[model samples]
Target: MAPPFAGGEEDEEARWCGLSTDMMEMILKHLPIADHISVSIACKSWRLATSDIILPALRAPWLLGSPMASTSLSWGFYTSSNGGQSLGLEIPTEFQRQWCCGSSKGWLMHLREPRNHSQYYEAHLLNPITGATVELPPFPPTVIKGVISTSPFATDFMLAALCFESTNFDKYVIVYQPRHPRRKKILIDNAMDIMFHHGRLYILTDLAELLVGVFDPRWKVSFKSIPTLFEEEGRHPDTYWGKLVESNDGVFVVYCTITTGAERQQLKVFKIKEWGRHHRIVEVKSLGDRTFFVGPFSDGVSISKMKSSSKLNIIKPDHIYYITGSEYSLWAHCMQKRHTFRVEEFKMTGNILEWFIPKLEDRSNLMVVTPTHSTSLLLTIIIVMLAVIGQCLLGWLSI
Candidate 1:
């Protein structure tokens, strides 16, 4: 009976399954990382091909047109991975003169200039991912204190917040501001600017008060002011734009105080752990006119310190770029080293620099400052123990 249909016959049957390698590749492309790993172990062919697949391309789509699209105002480009020079996409001429903020899902928010000083401001929302561009609704009419800033840093959501006072209360409310720049000009005041933390939104006002707002997906915004730690100093001398940064855990409140007849900018990082609120403040050299905390938090939680010197911004966690400034040099506090990128710094120039560093964007690639082999072994043991407890739940589910 043809040797009981064994060996060659079985091979023929497997071949008749008609699974083309090309079809397998296509199927594996859409699977999540965990599923991909699971599938590779099913057979030898998939194991070889899946191991060779490039992972980053599987990430969500983003804008990669031009970093220098604006003729009127220069723009900077940033991503979690090392952004290739070829990936830079230029903004269309229509968006050249206007202020634009780009979100994680490739949403571009631009403010169209008004015809007259008193004319209403116009804004548009363009999703580069879906290529859906539409005008936004008008925001609450208040004199928005400052311009909108967009962070390339990846978070749960791309956010925008504004700070304003209600005429009734001397206190200001930081609104969960949307990415509507034109509405900002019409409805919002200059006291507001966008700030994000641990996927939360905050309104940072000119008074140095941070009003954190929590909102639902329905666009119903609510405001809660983060009371200052300053001990009754009568409204702690106006904190500036460059002073606020979100750390690995919470937010770092930075402000320059005149102590003992010298200007000292105290970098105080606030972390909320199981033990409650904790503060870590350090006296560092040359607090950039503006610096963004980008990682390698001393703990398992990583934190990045991004500081600006001139047009060149030293974004910590690697992938440095000259986004805005006349000079390419930066006084990096982490490395405690000065770096210059030559003429590239002039590509985008300014001091009123405001932009977002997408949170944990390039986190994995960051050079973590870790301890020696002995300490690493200890950490590994702790991690393994934690993993055991975590996997136990999965094992129980299978039963």
Candidate 2:
């Protein structure tokens, strides 16, 4: 046999070739998900061994983190998959000047303003994973004309790039400064007052007018206004004030306080959903002011009677932590239960609540206050049973 096959080296090579693809795949599977990527480049054999594993595992990070962190005004990003390190992309130095954002789907949107002599404003969509960037076309001439004459108006431009409409994978840009001369229909002047809720962008332009716009990567890029019921209400416009609250189900509701002189004010809640056509408004009487005193506040122009509006800090879709001040004391409302805490009850001067979105795994940190409606009666039964069982002598004796 040795004489016939050169010490049987041919047999060894054949045995290596005879190894099953299944065995190779099994070895590749044992490697860490990240190292599996490197294993694919080991050789043609290993690359084939790893091809099917990349996609399913690569998309894991995309499906887990908080979508708001990627597209919100805070511009916060967190990833647990990459050793818990946030992706450090090179943000342009002009990012603050122009506006920049990252989407939940791992894409970035950058907006650039026109220079002294140029008439064009630039926007780009970038995929950091592949390092591919696509330049969005300039705003239409009419839109551009509208932005330039209104220098500060261009600065009021707000942008949202949504890769998928049904999902929360979107990016938002808010510009708070005036646009350059001859710039297009983009405005960021009121960008600071703008916030993204659900799939739409809402800008609190008025104590009255609420500007609602949809961000479409495939269109001319203009804000199609939605109807705000309070937009038409009367009296010293300064007397009527409002604030926005975003529900978890992607619905936005405005809590408006209309002061009737300095003593009386009415609190009204209006829900804004959809946009044109299907947009519906519903008034919620479930919430109201804690009889907080209406004040004489000034709106720059004149001293007008204004009410200290009930400030709602959204804890989640169904939970709102509202803070209101009365002539006697301060109050906090969570799940319709009102608790009054005096000005010095503990130690705090400003608003007591801070709103935040939790990561998928970190949700246990949140206090989920369930509504006490008929729907929660079933849950109440379960809780009461468990509590009784824990205290009953017979229950513990049987266990």
Candidate 3:
């Protein structure tokens, strides 16, 4: 195809360079961080536009390639940015073989059974980019799901997992901090799904009952119960799926219940609101600008905060991509089009296919600025300048 605008090469160049700074910045917002960084070096105006904009959390997650793919044994090496395409990844060979159970805040749960304890599995918090591994505490082998508060690269972050305790199948949620010697345990018999939102852990119980767990600075937690969303069906579990999804508005508890009939499975979504003593959940009519994806395990992601150029364009908004009925039985609930259909291409039957997202920014460029380092560095620079000035004065006086 030929170019749409017809002009001399010089004239076309001038037209692009003439765009105002605000307009240039607006255009750059639709591009990925790396792509915009590349555009910055093109000219002065483009550089000025991109310099001040804060780098955001790229929302579209990378779908781990099918375990059966032929690429590098495809264990964890290959990735599909969009559902249809494949890309080669340089993940470490050790990580390539581990079972990827869950992902949160751009970190994957890499678990391996070395000694094979009936209760726990040996695991490492993997940094795929550098292949740097942090030895993590023993994690439950039978985990329902887990999440990390922030990048483990930071000094303080928490890993929370909900799993059965032992052979009797007692439900327990364990919280692990990096430097802490012991893990904190919360025994909630009927808890369905858990989410860490706004510094508080929200535990979803039977029939959409909300339990908010408030954590202290020391990691001690206290629970506050919120009112139920709807009338109770019975003591039996009504929530087939309950996940805390981030929307454009805020973090919301999205719970789904399946219809009792056998012909086709129907799913309902509900959003929670806070009231004086009793928080409330309203049935969600549509997903506003959020694509919620849930796999067979306990991981669900709201893919909303993304750039257009980011390969995550494969995930569409107002849609829910989930595996129900069976592992291979994948369905997409498209609310905008009011349509639901089976997604056949994504069907993976044999090996586990968990959604993996590592932070895109190079770690060396990232910094955590606290009073501890910044203040000391400032003092050191001042001291060096003062010493140089003193030495110069002495030399001049001696001369």
- Give the clash count for model 2: 16
Please provide, for model 2 over 61-113, each residue's C-alpha lDDT reduced to its tens digit, 9 standing for 90 to 100.
Answer: 22112222234222222222222223332323344343443232233445566
All candidates' TM-scores? 0.43, 0.33, 0.67
Cα displacement (Å) at residue 163, model 3: 1.3
lDDT of 2 at 294: 15
Badly placed stretches (over 4 Å) of model 2 are 1-185, 188-192, 218-220, 231-236, 256-266, 287-346, 350-353, 360-399
Cα lDDT over the full model 3: 0.59
Residue 334, candidate 2: how far off, in angstroms? 8.9
- Candidate 3 lDDT over residue span 281-300, tens digit each: 67777777777876644346
Top candidate by TM-score = 3
Worst 10 residues of 3 by lDDT: 365-374
Q: How well does candidate 1 score on lDDT at residue 144?
A: 32
Which candidate leads in lDDT? 3
Ranking by lDDT: 3, 1, 2
